[model samples]
Target: MKFALAQINTTTEVADNLEKVRTYTRDAAEAGARFVVFPEATMSAFGSGLRTIAEEHMESWRSALSELAVETGITVVVGEFATTADKVINLLAVYSPSGERSDYAKIHLYDAFGFKESDTVEAGEEPVLFTVDGEDIGLALCYDIRFPKLFAELSRRGARLTVVAASWGAGPRKAEQWEILARARALDSNMFIAALGQADPEVTGVAVPKKGPTGVGHSLVSDPLGKVLNSLDGAERLEIVELDLSAADTAAETVPVLTNAKLGY
Candidate 1:
């Protein structure tokens, strides 16, 4: 199956972000992709007023996702936020053409690199996965990629491919760390890892709020064997790559990391 990885700069405006999603979904659908993955902060970028949009625009966000799925006949996974009384939940919203919709809240909040995501975002308790045509797809967010246990748990629960949505912070070796972490997680879980990141704002000349982990665009996909199939530089782009989903099974059969594990989640 073919998958499209969407890399674009997220903004503080939700409407503009949704329009970007629609445009990318159309492009992916026309290119014969069954699944299209958008990076984190698809609803709005990480800046001030995040909670406001999460509170007011959540219903419309869901509506757009559902409508996109039904219209394009493809499963859509995009990042969004849902408001809580005290904070917001960083969410990965999933929509299938069959009218099935589900979400995975971000389990691991970004509390590192001098950023305190937990101050505004609540962490998810459960690891989530959904199926498309009998092929299981796992869900994860930015900091979640750092925890190998989550990936193993998703694979334990039957996932051949994992989607990691991120709006990575820009700093020393951060981009390299993102790439290494993606490849390492692919190896750890023995599954295909699609690491989608937001486009670098600097590339687009968009002034982002300071101290925000806006983006450092280098979205990529790693096969079960941890080989990079395709990757993007720091730019806004929509790249598609086909995957032999069955390769996950072969990698598992050859390495057997999940089966031969001495640990458990």
Candidate 2:
């Protein structure tokens, strides 16, 4: 399957970010990618008023993304905020070419690294997997990559590829940790892991809220056997990557971790 990893920066403005989404999705479609995956917080960056945005513009975001997907003939999976009564949900929305929209709320909250995401957002209760061309692909948000169980469960549910979208925080060794976690999760689940993150604001030259997981920007694509297929530095990028979905079977035969697992699932 051919997919594109869209590592673009965002701001607190919904209209502005929506324009970026259109441009990148068109470019990816032109590059012959059937689908495009973007980082978390794509609608409005993390530091914005998520509740207000979700309440006021969530439908518009969905409408625009669905139209973009149908127009480009490509699947669009991007992160946007979902509103509740009081707080917001870190939503990973899937907009397919058929005009159907699905979403996965972020299960893991970023309550580490001096940040308390739980204070603002609620955790999701389920995992979401979508199929394209008969191939299963799973969805996750920024902090969800740290948990191996999520990936394993997705693989057990017959997902060969997983996209982990992020707005990873910048700090000492944080980038290294992000890379390591992605590779480990691929190995843990014996499936492909596409860890796409927001481009560093320093690289995008976009000033954002100073108090959350803005970005660290080292997007990566790992094979089923935990090999780094492609990686990006701290910059904005939209690259098409060809994936062999069948490789998951090969890795499962070689590792067999999922088959031999006894607990913690």
Candidate 3:
């Protein structure tokens, strides 16, 4: 399957961000991508003051995702603030070509970064996976990347590809760490991995910046062998890569790590 990683800079306005997402999805479709993975909080700005910019209605966000899926005819893994009746959930909504909707809330929060994500968002309790084009695709958000247990669980459940949408912050070391960790997860789980991150301002939060600036963008797509097949530099852009789930499955079987995993978490 062909996948496109959308690197967009979201702002305070939800409508504007949705339009940007549409335009990018079209760009991905034009590039012949069958599925597109967007950054976390694809419809809203991220950061310390995010509480003010957060959406209160999951229905509105769901409607936007549904329309985008229908119009583009491309399966999309989008990031959004999931607001429920009881609490808010930072989640990734998976929209299929047939207009079906499903989601996975973020399990890990970045509370150490002078932020209190757990305060506003409820953490998801289970590892979630969805099927697309006959492939079992696991879903996760930013911070969740650090938890190997999540990947192990998804791998055990027969997920062939793990798609992540994130707003990874700046810092060269952190950027490098993101790459290493992503590859590690894929290699250990023996599954194909696609890690998508938003541009800088979209990640820095509302108290930081809105838009009109470059982000420390380093979006990447890796094979089960932990080889980076496609990479986008620091810029707001779209990257498309074609992959074969069968090849990844072959590599996983050859390694057999999933079968021998210790199930630590």
Candidate 4:
């Protein structure tokens, strides 16, 4: 299957962001991409008290994305926020080509690097996995990338691919850490991993008072062997990579790491 990782500069304006999503979804569909994954908070500005915005525009956002998925005939996995009874949840919304929708809330919140995501966002309790083209694809958010156990559980549940939506803050060695963790997860799980990030400049004006820019958009796709098949630099762009579903099985056969792994209690 061919997957497109869309790296965009998301802004506070929901309409403008939705337009960008439409444009990019069209481009990806025209390029023969069956699935397109967008960066976290693609529907709204991150760190801008997202709960308020999510409560106001959740239905509109869902309607637009579902329409786009049905129109373009491509599956979309994009980031969004949702308001629960108690707090807001960071989410990855999946829109299938058939217009069916599913979502995964972020399990891990970003509480390091002087940021306190937990102050407003509530953590999710479970993982989400869906099938596309006979492949089980796992869903995760930005901070979840740092936890190996999450990916391991997805692999154990027969996920051939893991898609991560991120709004990773840029700082000392942050980009390097992103690459290292992405590759490590793929290698450890023997699954194709797609880590998509939001670009800078657009997220620069977010409510967070940071020392520097927030996002370092180096969205990448890694194969089962931990090899980066395609990647983008610090720019707003879209890159598609074709993945062989059987490759994960092949890697598992060659390495047998998944079979050999044991939890040390």
**Whole-model Cα lDDT of every candidate shown, in order:** 0.90, 0.92, 0.78, 0.85
RMSD of candidates 1 onward, in order: 1.2, 0.9, 3.2, 2.4
- After superposition on all CA atoms, how large is the RMSD of candidate 3? 3.2
Tell me the tens digit of each residue's lDDT in model 2 across 1-265: 9999999998889999999999999999999999999889999998756788778898888899999999999999999988777789889999999999999999989888777999989889999999888888999888899999999999999999999999999999999999999999999999999999999988888887887888999999999888999999998999789988889999999889998998666
Q: What's the lDDT for residue 72 in model 4?
A: 93
**Number of the predicted model whose TM-score against the real structure is largest:** 2
- Cα lDDT of model 3 by residue, 61-128, tens digit: 67877988898898888888855555567888889879898889888986755656677677888788
Backbone-clash count (model 2):
0
- lDDT tens per residue, model 4, 1-265: 8878888877777888899999999999999998899988888767555677888889999999999999999999999888878788889999998989998989999898887888878999899998787778999999999998899889989998999889888878998999999999999998989998887654334343243224788888888889998888877888877878799999989987878988730
For candidate 4, which ten residues in a row score worst on lDDT? Answer: 204-213
What clash count goes with each model? 0, 0, 3, 0
Against the true structure, candidate 4 reaches a TM-score of 0.93
- Judged by TM-score relative to the true structure, which candidate is superior, 1 or 2? 2
Off by over 4 Å in 4: 202-213
What candidate 2 gets wrong by more than 4 Å, as runs, is none
Candidate with best lDDT: 2
Better of 3 and 4 by lDDT: 4
Instruction: Tell me model 4's lDDT, rounded to 2 decimals.
Output: 0.85
